[model samples]
Target: MQATNTLPLDMVYHWEATKADSLYLTQPVGNDQVVEYTWGRAVDEARRMASYLKSLNLPEKSRIGLISKNCAHWIMTDWTIWMAGHISVPLYPTLNAETVNYILNHAECDVLFVGKLDDWEMMKPGVPDSVRCISFPLSPPNDFETWDDIIARCSPLEENVQREPEELATIVYTSGSTGKPKGVMLTFLNMAYAAEGGMEVLKVGSDERMLSYLPLAHVFERTFVELASLYAGFHLFFAESLDTFVEDMQRAQPTLFLSVPRLWVKFQQGVLQKLPQKKLDTLLKIPVVNKLIKKKILKGLGLDKVKLAGSGSAPLAGDVLDWYRNLGLELLEGYGMSENFAYSHINKPGRSRTGYVGENMPGVETKISPEGEILIKSPATMLGYYKDEEKTKETFTEDGFLKTGDVGEIDEAGRLRITGRMKEIFKTSKGKYIAPAPIENQLMANQSIEQVCVSGANQTQPFALVQLAEGVRDKVADEAYRKELETTFSQLVDRVNKTVDPHEQLAFIVVMSDEWTIENNFLTPTLKLKRNVVEDTYEGKINDWYAQRKKVIWQ
Candidate 1:
């Protein structure tokens, strides 16, 4: 019940003995098939793998690379690495060969565990030939040794290995929205503090079910979902693919749910596709029908059972947060980063306010620097960036608070409202600095706008490049639809411009013909816009876009 000082491996061992027969993970294979792992079975497999890893005779605390989409084996492999007295390094599955190569080499990984991924072919070349490779059950065809084969030959490690609290547990790389990713070194204690504190605060019970589709490589999902489940002993489910997401959600019937801002908006748009926003708003006014309609809508999205829903990884629009709340779902927005094990601040159940990521956590301290950057000190704070002491030194203050790099203000109630990224703010030719996030959030209120990147470094005024929503983009070819969209966006820009300072107001909105995606290098693996990449890709067209001078320019 109390916040735990126990490490993650200890929690796994605890569950293995007490909840041995309980269903722990449900991993969906392709074609509606699922493979379930009980606490006993999962631990046994991890032990056998641990024995295999020991046989390899790697150095103590050697870095072991893990590249996988969220899967049962990914969790088990992490356990195996810890049990064998090594450090786990998880790479985002969406990484290109170059980035993958850089991380593995930079970390000096001795082994690489390849698991369920959509882009194995592209990432395979990144694996160093010197490091041994092991493939999970769901991994694509490869010449590497298989997990089942190793488990078949090896015996479960009988010794109950306990890791030191301060021992390095994992290295989670950043999503690289700005530049090359940095390896964040987290200890066992760091992981425990975040997971146990979150579990206790959220009141997660052993009976709770959760779906894990977000990249476990990201600290947000790793600490909150994966590690928290270890402490809470909740049933975790892995999503198979994007196409089967709704079905997978329905199958899990998760009591706890976590999502990012973009997906939350997409879910809203999906609901609007069936029931127009105007009609849904009218229906909600009718009390009796409203309850039924809300329930039905949530059920269709496979989130009717979700009780403790959370939104994080980016700022969710206040309206979108309200939309989910109107359906009687208690949605909370959290704030954290890779440097702190993603355990900074979280909106408490009843104390939540839209547009603000709630008060500092129980053992967390927050203060704004003179320059407007939010600084945090938490029990879960990372040791430092791996092999980058200089950068690590630059990221923290003399008093030990980690510089969050996010500009925000603490309100009277102690809730944190993120204003903008310090690095992301840009100046117009007139020397007026513009914070784009608020304006972008305002622009996103329009259902047609999928993604927006506001930029104008030396230009007279800032402009926005937007990717139209999926359904909206499909209709762009139609002349009537195109005309309607132009008018809608024109009105959107005007409405958004009024909310900002005159200098900060957008000069125009350009609807891009292409979608920004991880594959295209426009978005980070965590789905945040890679501003530099997006800007550089369209640098030459900026002049053309401005020369057009139209309120809504189509590209």
Candidate 2:
């Protein structure tokens, strides 16, 4: 395989020949059992599967759909698609049947690979009978062809397969925060550029170990964990389930970790439950005790071996970032989008500044438009949206810069700090426009609040609708605790008000009784709040909430 501008398949071939017996993937089965795959064995399985795919005689570049949680066979199937000269389309495991149907038909999929999933019955109706179905070893009982059965019958593809850098590699659909999701078409070159660049910046190598729990359907994990592993030849581990996540993490002892803000906060809350904040703060002040305490906490969370940890996909609370820093962890924040394959910007190891996303990546240029939208031009920019040429043209400026919908500022040191989304800024009836993201971040600093949405679209003043944290909810049922929380939240609002302009100050906070979750469609699969869904759910009660004129009202 040629090394120049290498694609993922090229690196896969390189590792298979040089490190044939090296362990590449570790997958957890049920009941404390695991299966490991070596480089040679894994490629052999992919080769056999590729031969099976080729027998179908699908048209060149035909779309093949993959629906599964992160598992060993998921990666193998992706490689098989490319080797068979087909494009891959991965759907989020949590997507509803309606969305699954929409995506499969929209992509004109010829075949579907169904792997480990929790809700196969619910999603089964989504797969049109016209499309062929293949099942993985871990898949729920179905009549579809099994991976092991196909491998047993077929011979491995003997010739080394190579893909042109400009060929279509994958189509990733957005999480659909507002409306229908659009397919972002990324080429082999786009993925190669991002994976290679990230590997260089992070200094990853074969010695590095990482846990893959984030959805590979999303660009962030696909580019960093899947594609980067191919480039760097690192050991990758799959998380079994939510119940076994801690055990899985411990088994890997990952040298590199990546997480979203919500999971990071949950880890903090879990630690604080074991040791109260006041007592923990006092212990940390002692020079000798602080080191031991930090070590114990990291070890307990199965992160003692983590050399670098990152948070992305949403704005993390500043207070949460500071908490991790105090524990001697170098937690960095980054900024990117699906249009650029998430290769835009990341903080330098020793040069990171708090609250800023960091400087532009290598070979990337960024500029703030006159309207304050962040525009970026990078080596990994997508070819275009899958089939929407008009929308694709509108997304880019005449100079070829992708228009990121985020409004942000660049400092003198070139660090970028995001303010809010352009479409999320809502105007009140009093003719004042308020950006909700910064205010929501401020609200998240309070440990009692789990999720907050600040909306006052046509009202006189902005207000917050918040779901109380899980640990705090049980206590709120008690009369005494409820009154105490009311007082604490009142003071919290006053503090937040003093920091913002008069119009931006919130009128009150509404404690919601209902939970916001992916199952309820209040949050995207990536855990981002769907503002439109949240606002519409409470539109009829906004006037009632304000009529009480209380500092805090419980819904």
Candidate 3:
């Protein structure tokens, strides 16, 4: 459980010595093509990239921008930036031109590495002419140097390059859910401490396998996928695209799987499509039949081999956790933020609390403020917000605890149940305050609901704006499906309302056909809903929604 007090590049060197011939990265190319990189080859390629970057003759500690989906080249680019003594600035692939431009200019990025974009045309306008651009494998059309060409032309770095543990490593930007994304400056020590603390609790091995599909720009994926892999020597697999996700998972048979709650709900819905919930529940009651059912279900979802599965980046409903546990898959819930490198708390395996994120991680300290905000002090805490001293000072306590902004309380056992965001609690016209997260979590138990936002500021009672799960639209035209949905949702709302305070009961459920996506700005890169944006977009229609006599109104 001792921390690896070495830099990321130093850990890479350790892996090169211990696991030279082992596979480090697996990237899928075409339908039948895949590219594999051994530890030695990966290091060599990274060294070549470092050489090329060094050739640019940029100032020491210059910022380098990386924009791409999760892929092998993305990790390679990060290693190259670190080895070349530069700071990495990652951009979400789904970012708009304006946001991308803002991050690059604000960071004063001297060079950019572009890789595998969904829409290059949309992002092209944001690239400043002053900054040089380089392209990675499978890059889009652009007047920039290619990754392959650089590797072929540049000589590999001959000697080892090291960084101090306290030196600046990367600048991670927040998801911009509340406002403009602010740059968070994280040092090598911060990232190393987080990786070490997480691994100490998780106890992963070199043989552990993982799939990389989440946005690497987010601290969650970067910590688990990139930093953890370096610290633990785990083999990382990259999904080809959305189309091949299941196949990729099946191929990797990952031992550790991590995902957001949205995808977990989708997986449950997919199983429900094949076998109705009632039938599955009945079969699960029988001992022998239950084992077979769980096996088949897990295999179908490509999670049969996953010994550790987790849900994070948002609150997971108790029902969802129970559903997975019923099928013999223990879904651990975790809580953290970008400011802390996601090294706060995680439910330990075989001892998970159903409704709470587990104990504070090793070497991390946590306490609740008088205002009920969760404050954490850890070695993994970011140094400060880049070039924003005022905002940085506002985010931390005078005593040095990082203010998490989440309102939560710790139980007697030290488990944490996140109630809601401090700023998200809405006051109704009836002078009652409502916490929307718990209500939203309860509503999400209904299979028909994909996402929900509860709002009623200045209203008598709060109501829910709901988005239906995928494929629900195609089935809506069928009379039976429509009736079944209406019946289920009606019963669900009634059941949930009876469990909550009367003032907190939802007035009506506004079912909307529109989808919330990262591309559309409704969801952040981490799949968290932008509540302020959702409320702003639907504020004008709340009056009509409230006037409807029916409990469920479709928009």
Across 340-400, the per-residue lDDT of candidate 2 in tens digits comes to: 8988989888888878898887778899999999999987999889999998999999999
Candidate models: Cα lDDT each: 0.91, 0.91, 0.90
Model 1: per-residue Cα lDDT over 16-54, one tens digit each: 999899999999888889999999999999999999999
lDDT by residue (tens digit), candidate 3, 1-555:
344577788898898888889999999887768899999989989999999889889999999999998889999889899999999999999899999899999999999999988987998899899989999887778878899998998899987899988999999999878788999999999999988888889998889999999999999999988998989998999988888888999878999999999999999988987898899989989988889999999999999999999988999889999999988899999988899998899999887888898989998889999999999998889999999999999999999999998999998888988998889998989899898999999999887788999989989888888999886767888888888888877777798789899899877888888889888889998888999899998888888777777788878
Question: Deviation in angstroms for 510 in model 2?
Answer: 0.7
Give the distance in Å from residue 109's predicted Cα in candidate 3 to where it truly belongs.
0.6
Give per-model TM-scores. 0.98, 0.99, 0.98
Between candidates 1 and 3, which one is better according to lDDT? Answer: 1
Error of 2 at 65 (Å): 0.4
lDDT of 3 at 158: 81
Q: Per-candidate RMSD vs. true structure? A: 1.2, 1.5, 1.3
Lowest lDDT 10-mer window, candidate 3?
1-10
